[model samples]
Target: DAGVTQSPTHLIKTRGQHVTLRCSPISGHKSVSWYQQVLGQGPQFIFQYYEKEERGRGNFPDRFSARQFPNYSSELNVNALLLGDSALYLCASSTNSQGRYEQYFGPGTRLTVT
Candidate 1:
């Protein structure tokens, strides 16, 4: 089956513009999460959804938001973008069967705000 998929492998925007990134999880999986990775930094959790419910979120401003669909797909929406928002937006998916969960990441959507 297909792994995680994200759109617009890269992105560029100006300050204050809104951007929405999309993600589709692997087949038969029900957990998806969004993360932001800056230069030389690790991916920081933004939001996590499981079974169509919000499971967790990260230390981000109100400008960051996300949602998960019934088909296990997800979207990350950032509004009133700022310079600090420039980073690689990653989408991760995993199954809910094992005791430990390992995420499978997409290539990421690089958001650059100038």
Candidate 2:
């Protein structure tokens, strides 16, 4: 079966622009999450959606948001892009939110701010 998949793979934008990253979870998965990974740092959890509801969020600003669909796919939207926002946006999927199951991650969407 296919794992989590992200679109565009790469993106470029200027400061103050808006960007949307997409993800499609594996088959039969119900929970989707988003993360941001900056160079030399670990991945930071951004949002987690279960059954189309927001379950968790990190310390990111209001400009970051995400949503899951009925099919378990998701989209992460970042507004007012900044140089600091340039990083790899990763999407992960799991069978549940209890952390009992292993989560699978996508290759990630690389965002670059010029």
Candidate 3:
């Protein structure tokens, strides 16, 4: 079975620019969640999409948004990126069986804002 994966291991952008990060969930998984990990901080939930329906979101500004597709893939978009927005974006996926939350994570896409 394939594990979760993300693209563009690293990126750099100036203030006000926008970026989109991609993620692919493991086979047989229907739940995907997005998280942002800033320097020296734990991963904070950005969005959780199950069956292409949003399940949850965290305390982020309007500049942050995301969506899940039919194929179970997802994309996270950040608009008007700020220096504070520079962080490692992580994508996790897990089975929806009862009491399962030990999500598997992919190497995050690290975004650096100048």
Candidate 4:
């Protein structure tokens, strides 16, 4: 049983470019969530999807978005990238959407902006 996995372990981008990060959840899991962690700060929740429906969203701007697939995989898309967006983008997966289940996190996709 593998945990969550994220692609492109690292990314380099310019201020206005858009990027899409991918994630695959553990087998049998049905919920996937995204988070942004700036250096020296806690992870900020970006989005959570369960059963292919959006369950929650954080305070992030409209530039941030995500969706879960029928297979329980997910993608996080960030548009109009800014320097401030440079951070470790983490993907977490759980068994349910009630926030009560244990969540497994990925190694994270490190994003760097210039």
Candidate 5:
């Protein structure tokens, strides 16, 4: 099976701008998660959705939002982007069965805010 995929491998934007990043989960996965990773730091959880419903969210500001489609794909939107928003946006697909959960991540979308 193919892994998760993210669009616009790289993106550049100016401060105060907005961006929308897309992600396609792996086949048969019903859960999707979004994360942000700054240089030299681990990925920080942003949001998670299961069966198209939001399950969890991290400490990000209101400028961050996301939605999962019926097809299991997800999109992350950031408003009023700041230079600190520059980082790798990651998408992960996972499965939860009998209390066991496994997640697989995509290559990630690199965003740069100038």
Candidate 6:
């Protein structure tokens, strides 16, 4: 099977603009997560959708949002972009069978807000 995959490997946006990043999970996975990684810092968890319902969220502002599809794919959307939003948007996939979840991450989409 394949690992998680992200689209538009790179992106650029401006302040006040909106952007969307896409993700596809590994086959048979039922959960997906979004993360943001800034330079010199660890990745910060953003959102997690299990079975198409939001299961978790981080301290991000309301400008950040995400959704999962019935096929297990997912999307991360950001509105009213700010320079601080520029970072590598990562997508991860996992499965929870016995209260344990392991995640596989994609390379990430690099978004630069100008």
The TM-score measured for candidate 6 stands at 0.96
Q: Indicate the residue-level lDDT of 95 in model 5.
A: 84
When summed lDDT is taken over every stretch of 10 residues in candidate 5, the lowest stretch is 94-103
| Model 5 alpha-carbon miss at residue 81, Å | 0.3
Q: Can you give the TM-score per candidate against the true fold?
A: 0.96, 0.96, 0.97, 0.95, 0.97, 0.96
- What local distance difference test score does each model get? 0.93, 0.94, 0.94, 0.93, 0.96, 0.95
Q: How would you encode candidate 1's per-residue C-alpha lDDT over 79-105 as one tens digit per residue?
A: 999999999999999989678878899
What tens-digit string does per-residue lDDT give for candidate 5 at 14-76? 999999999999999999999999999999999999999999999999999999999999999
lDDT of 4 at 62: 96
Worst 10 residues of 6 by lDDT: 94-103
Task: Give one digit per residue, the lDDT tens place, for model 6 in 1-114.
Answer: 889999989999889999999999999999999999999999999999999999999999999999999999999999999999999999999888777767899999999999
Candidate 4 — what's its lDDT?
0.93
Shift in Å, residue 30, candidate 1: 0.6
Error (Å) of candidate 2 at residue 44 is 0.3
Could you give candidate 4's per-residue lDDT for residues 39-108 as a string of tens digits? 9999999999989999999999999989888888999999999999999999998886575778899999
- Extract clashing residue pairs from model 5: none
User: How close to the true structure is residue 70 of candidate 4, measured as C-alpha lDDT?
Assistant: 82
Least well predicted 10-residue stretch by lDDT in candidate 4: 93-102
Misplaced by over 4 Å in model 2 are 97-99
Off by over 4 Å in 4: 97-99
lDDT of 2 by residue, 11-66 (tens): 99999999999999999988999999999999999999999999999999999999
Candidates 1 and 4 compared: the better one by TM-score is 1
What's the CA RMSD for each of the models? Answer: 0.8, 1.2, 0.7, 1.4, 0.8, 1.0
Instruction: Estimate the overall C-alpha local distance difference test score of candidate 2.
Output: 0.94
